[model samples]
Target chain A: MKSLHAQHHPLADTGYQLTVLTQAEVEGAHQPLFATRLREAGLLPLRPTGITVMQVNVGKMCNQTCRHCHVDAGPDRTEIMTRATMQQCLDALRQTPIEVVDLTGGAPEMNPDFRWFVEQISALGREVIVRCNLTIIVANPKYYDLPEFFARHRVRVVSSLPHFSAVRTDAQRGEGVFGRSIKALRMLNEAGYGVEGTGLSLDLVYNPSGAFLPGNQAALEREFKQRLVREHGVVFNSLLTITNLPISRFLEYLLDSGNYESYLDKLVQAYNPVAAANVMCRSTLSIGWDGQLYDCDFNQQLDLLVDGRAPQHIRDFDLAALNERSIVVNQHCYGCTAGAGSSCGGATT
Target chain B: MEKATYYNPADLAKFGNITEWQPEMGRKFFDYYGEVFKDGALTEREKSLIALAVAHAVQCPYCIDAYTTDSLQKGADEAQMMEAVHVAAAIKGGAALVHSVQMMNKAKELSM
Candidate 1:
């Protein structure tokens, strides 16, 4: 599937996506404003708790265009972060005590400077997390050595596998993706990434394929462990259940399939205050491909920059200013606070 | 009463309003329903599948919609949920077929 950008779809525009989220109303559904909900929880003007994870979107050039991708990332994308911007990120990291550097992209490894950036982050003694699309490791001959490189750096690898079954998994992602993902998992296992004693954490992410919230994280993890190990001899440390935020291609999907209003209603109805207080945006800062900063990846996708009170670019990394700035939010914020709550790690509450 | 159709998908959301008139019974029923779905000898996922099967067996549109979403949220995948529906169908069909024995017995006795 081509990306929204590639297809010239209007939803590809971040401003348009935000407008659709905020202004478009379906008949008979009274979707409450997310900010109002937060206010009710005494969390209006949500500010950062502290910076812990610096999630960097290295690029938007992914190998496959998945249907539910909020990033609108695909092979057709050309939004690669430059070495200079990466240097700026490393410089910012050196200045702040932020403990974890998360690298994500169309495929983070696809960036020419990906290895250099990983080594640089590792040298700084900060934990590195590569949000790898598993198939990227097996997509080409050059990427075959990713497991060894990741192991050498002791980088935590996180990948998304929507479902254990090939049919359901492929339906959301792409055809034959499940097979490639399993092959990549075996390779990661051979490198001892997810092995019990290795301490090299490799986690899989599970987001619902269609318009529904994720199931209980613990139960899903247990089921994934049993199925992957029994059927394919794959092992992983944990499963991170992510709620699909309504943005970009996913927003396009909801609009196209007539699930937008109901899905938003579902998210709003399941809003949990505990989860609201623990949103990843409170702690994680998202860096875009061109060094722009945002509250979280979802906001980054929507072009919702960090509040003007904070430094808007990575080059001007101001931990104090950012910590003081209120997190930019919209209706999409409901996804993070719904049900058990969702974040980069897993359920928040 | 003004609507042409008897069943509106939107009515599913209003199911909670049942408590408005019969608060005591509604609360008790909902409390028991919640407890029934909790993980026990049968996992919540299993129970969701069962609810989905029963929803089909009883042919309740509201239930089918509710439990379909519940089953998905409980981690039951497409194939598993569909199989649950098929189980309900198989039993429903078998129940009617099984009554053929009584029909045959009555027919033979009358003929004699």
Candidate 2:
């Protein structure tokens, strides 16, 4: 609380080194950690209680540079998941009880072997989800066949469109992104996603266009449903209204826009015990592009790698070990527990 | 260290000092107050907008400062939040206006 104007400065230039200062703030803040807040509400630090979702960052290589991209992904980003790392993730999946393999990245599909990876994940009988940036679908010719490919594998697609309005979507993501996203959504619809009985689920993600948290999940879903169907003839199974976590690009936005202190205060003030109890960290395992592990994707983004005793990397994954280690937490975690709470899949509460 | 003004923006952060003066009751109140805002029958956003409206009527700079941020954090747009304040203003004004019937009744009784 000692004038965190210093700590709240964007780490745009510093990269992962911000992790150290983040930890210090978590330790020294007058407010308690979200973990401690949870404990006070009777939810104590337990092991990776139950890992149902294994989120693997395939790489940071992305086609578009969204303002709030937590992955720091962009076209120039060279880091990518190699075949070996992908195989290791597959190996970990085979050995563990994880039934959902969530693939994320600058653009998960941008990887050369992305198709091979999805096919393999499906072969393991795991539910595969791609955290797609919709623009990727229409970004290039190589991606043109994605709709057909996704349908064949029955891959669950979760893409961020931000809003039903093109101006809003394009404003946050980039110019021309809204057009590409609508085209991509229609293509996914053509492939049977969000259709009545096809079982190929196509979920859309909606994070706020700015520093604020997202509105109510169910209501926003309805509005998005009506607008998309009415205006674009697009359909989707469900919509996830996510609270933007203060990390990476979003943290930069808050700092740059002078909302950093107030935003953090707002997150702390709106802490919901119920949402904190059901946080995604309690049930998910996050894997970095390099196979390093984390409690969640936000933690992965910070490179706050999982605890010391836990299997630090997918290659060394031991369920029992991970199950016993306490989750790593910091101030940024307030984002996940604020209001209805947010996770990769959406609000927990 | 009481200031002449009853409320100061800086005092919002130091609101925690209330506990130092009265630990037992202060701790109890803070705990109960936090529980009131959890996602329940009404969402946190709904609660925030309501809080914003109340802040206006109560005229507590601290509550107003807190709830304005809370309203935004809960994704209430500037326009919607301003509307909430307007709702508060109308309600506050109506409460006073409605009470004026008593003044009219007193005048009628005096004349009779």
Candidate 3:
């Protein structure tokens, strides 16, 4: 297994760094066969449950390059959502009756027009969800007031903290991310984001530091609340445990570490039919930074467009046709349906 | 025809296949097994740690394989997990040594 970092070829015309491991390559690792499992579980030909979430990936630019980052986002990555594309997504959001405007990126806050984007979404009176990497607030002095800004617009902030302890969190993110994240959580608390009655919600996302399905979400949330409060005196509304999809840098790690096949086997073996039925793609319409449509963010990253003859661009969004279109899924979908399950909001079943 | 080996670590994944031999009993056993792991008095993670320790004490390779992965997935660190194994080893060794008292009593009775 050679490093995909140095290997080249197959760049998207959009100039986004293309995944060396194609969809087929990612699917090659499947053991029990994701589709067969779905069919046996009576879950084939999965269709939308009506889109309620408009998940928008603003860009691939971030302050930290997490080892398991499915986005492969870092400071040097130039792929970002232009104001035009952002406008397109906003227009689609306005035209469609979608409720939650979910925003994500390398460090979505790193986008130059991120504040404007959040403000515009806020003005629509739609609930805004910002997938903030907690370190970004402490990474730069200019971003220090983000908690206040987030509170101002009543945005739901979901930040990633791979573990409660510094060792595991820093192992997954960078060396000092844990300390910085704790500081940022304190900042968010000060701004009343996670306060008992502020009406502003602050949540933490937990993904496994290695190649395994996430544990039970409710159980882990209790552990996180206990440890974060007991040790740092910080509190948050909830914890969202997301299973890392095998894509981007994480795929590379699996390959490099020789754990790809075994991990994929584990996912397939642990597949829950209930979880497969309730995958997030059923209720989420994901829009890429370049305004391309996808069934979910993982599909967006892999460049798997929504199925059939639907309009692929946000500007041309047709809610009826989009709702009627079948969601595109592949072996990677197992990551979402394994065990208690995982999704953007948290576990599925 | 060949008889199946008593324990094969690979058979851990095939535990569900026991239903192939005796569907009624296998299904019932698994139903109860699944129910036991659900969150209740003890969290699933705590159960996993306990399972890991018992796997060592019982020297069941299959249980060890399954529960080691389970413990890690449930957020048990290497130290915590290893400490659990040590607890099982300590109890097992203590249990074995305490039985020496029976051997001492038998020798005394025979000599008297």
DockQ of each: 0.74, 0.24, 0.53
Instruction: For each candidate, give the interface RMSD after superposing the true interface residues on Cα.
Output: 1.0, 3.9, 1.3
Model with the higher lDDT, candidate 2 or 3: 3
Query: Cα deviation of A220 in candidate 2 (Å)?
Result: 0.9
Docking outcome class, model 1: medium
At residue A236, give the lDDT of candidate 1. Answer: 95
For residues A1-349, write the lDDT of model 3, one tens digit per residue: 2123323413222123333333435556436557777778776777788999999999988888888888777776778999999998888888878989999988899889999999999999899999999988988799999999999999999999988888878888889889999999999999998889899899999998887777878888898898899999999999898988877778767877888767777777788899999999999999998999999998887778988588898889999998888777777788998888889989877
DockQ of 2: 0.24
Quick one: best lDDT, which candidate?
A: 1
Identify the superior model by DockQ, candidate 2 or candidate 3.
Answer: 3
Cα lDDT tens digits, model 2, A1-349, are: 1111223544644354365336546577755666678679876664566889999888888888888888777886778889999999888889987899899997999999899999999999999999988878888898988989999998999999898877768878988899989998888888898898999999999898876777778877876788899999999988897888888777777777987776777788879988877888888999988889999988887878888988898899898888788888777888888888888888888
How far off is residue B28 in model 1, in Å?
0.4
Q: CA lDDT, every prediction?
A: 0.93, 0.83, 0.84
| Alpha-carbon deviation at A116 in model 2, angstroms | 0.3
Index of the highest-TM-score prediction: 1
Compared with the true structure, what per-residue lDDT tens digits does model 3 show for residues B1-112?
6578887656777789989999999999999999999888999988999999999999989898888878767876677788999999999999999999999999999995
Q: A62-95, model 1: which lDDT tens digit per residue? A: 9999999999999999999999999999999999
| Each candidate structure's count of clashing pairs | 0, 0, 0
Q: TM-score for candidate 2, please give it.
A: 0.76
Q: What is the lDDT of residue B66 in candidate 2?
A: 82
TM-score of candidate 3 against the unseen true structure: 0.87
